[model samples]
Target: MRRRKDKHHANHERWLVSYADFITLLFAFFVVMYATSKADQRKQAEAAAAINSAFQSLGLFQSATPTKQLQGATDAGSAPAATQDETVTPMNVVMGDQMLASPQVQEDFERIKRHLEGLLSNQIARHVVALRIGREGLIISLREAGFFDSGSAVPHPSSLATLGQIAEALRTTPYDIRIEGHTDNVPIHTDLFDSNWELSTARATHLARIFIVGHQFAPARLSASGYAEYHPTASNETADGRAQNRRVDIIVLPRVTTPASPAVHVPAAKPAAIAAAIPAPTATAEATARPLP
Candidate 1:
């Protein structure tokens, strides 16, 4: 008779191998997550440090020691105490809260205004030229009748002396000069100008050229622009109002300080080329004829 076969043993501990592997994988995942979190915190601290340095350089903060101590206190789980030396001035207050120009700039504008008024007394009295402190710094308005002929970009021969005097006065200033040309609501078309856009731009560019070529003004300090029947100073319904609207403005811009950066110089287009590129006005009749209240 054959001997009884040995009893088969069922193993219960085979599942322990799989359980150990799962536990190891879970630990490794948590370790990776902790390392990533620490790296993010490090990056955040670096960015904050950079920003603090910039603010300190701008004179917004009195001292850098306080910022470093504050950061350390924060990391140590403590509230940072405010101190007199750590006070930060508001940016608005530092930059003049209410006025656009500084005290010195305002004084300079006043001086220039007085000088021009004295020299242009006759023109000012005749309403051919006006000087005022406008929102855009000092505005010297030159009416079309005094500076240029009707529908002509060229200044009258008699006006050259006046323009020369004005240029001479401005030549001493350090501020930038912007020559702005304006027109009335009346539409225009001619051999030289196709629309008010061309006429206005041509007038402004011509004045700019005279300042640069004739009076030896710095080209970098001069800019020209044209507003065709838009940005009107008075109503277009009356002749006197229209006369005021048709004018060229010489604006003295306020000086501003900014952080240095790399500059890219681009060649400026000629006035004629710019005018040709500008699209014609497409205002409807209702909008164009609407009277100012």
Candidate 2:
């Protein structure tokens, strides 16, 4: 009788199953590691792209391109000391120290100047706005004619782009934005828009909207108002002066630990030439304020 070889097999191969199981575990571990590594790489790329898009859109960071002569800016840490006393010195130098400090603020201004030169050149430079940094912060101004069409509330496309750049530069910058819209003395009456009051109001709102909505700037830090044909920078007596009268200002305030402006209604000052707050003038005075362009 075939003495059933009593299953002499000592089940020596049972260890093979254990070994196979161990191999599977090791393979799975490597796969997980590889997947995690790839995921991390993807996340980094996405973050870089987002930052690039943001900077480029704001004109704060440009692609590889040559800077133009009109562009009057120096690097942040490399600007020469301020030498032009003729240039208006910042006031209440308080905010300057707390946030940007004078040197950094000046650097920002230079950057802005260079950016503006790239976009607008000197044709509008005389009318171009100034970015003033002080203890209170930055004061950005836009001559009305350069920003809007006569008697209309719509923003010129160029103005919108410039404003976009400005917004980007101030992103996360802690400075509050004050949008001030001013109009000339001429009575504005268009079929679509009724009066300078309405037009000016619309313009201010439009600029504010770009920051609040387009750029997602904080609404709490932003405010807007219209000076309907009231805050004239030049005498309204002449076309040139009247033209100079219109403008928009974006004031960037410094970090204020306490209540600052007893009132937020400071009148827009006259041209840089006069260096004083002046009233709207008659048409004749406006004419004489500037020679024919």
Off by over 4 Å in 2: 1-137, 256-293
Candidate 2 accuracy as lDDT:
0.56
Error of 1 at 25 (Å): 37
The TM-score leader among the candidates is 1
Instruction: Summarize candidate 2's per-residue lDDT along 1-293 as a digit string, tens digits.
Output: 67765555567679999999999999999999999999998777667656654653332232232222122335556754433321112212232244334455556555654665555454356766654444334556677666666665666665666666667676546445667777788786656456566666666767776666566665656767777777676899998887766877776643221222222432322223111221222223211011112
Question: Which 10-residue window of candidate 1 scores lowest in summed lDDT?
Answer: 283-292
| TM-score per candidate, chains pooled | 0.56, 0.46
lDDT of 1 by residue, 145-191 (tens): 99888998777657777787788898778777888888999999876
In model 2, the worst 10-residue window by lDDT is 284-293
Clash pairs detected, candidate 1: none
Total clashes for model 1: 0
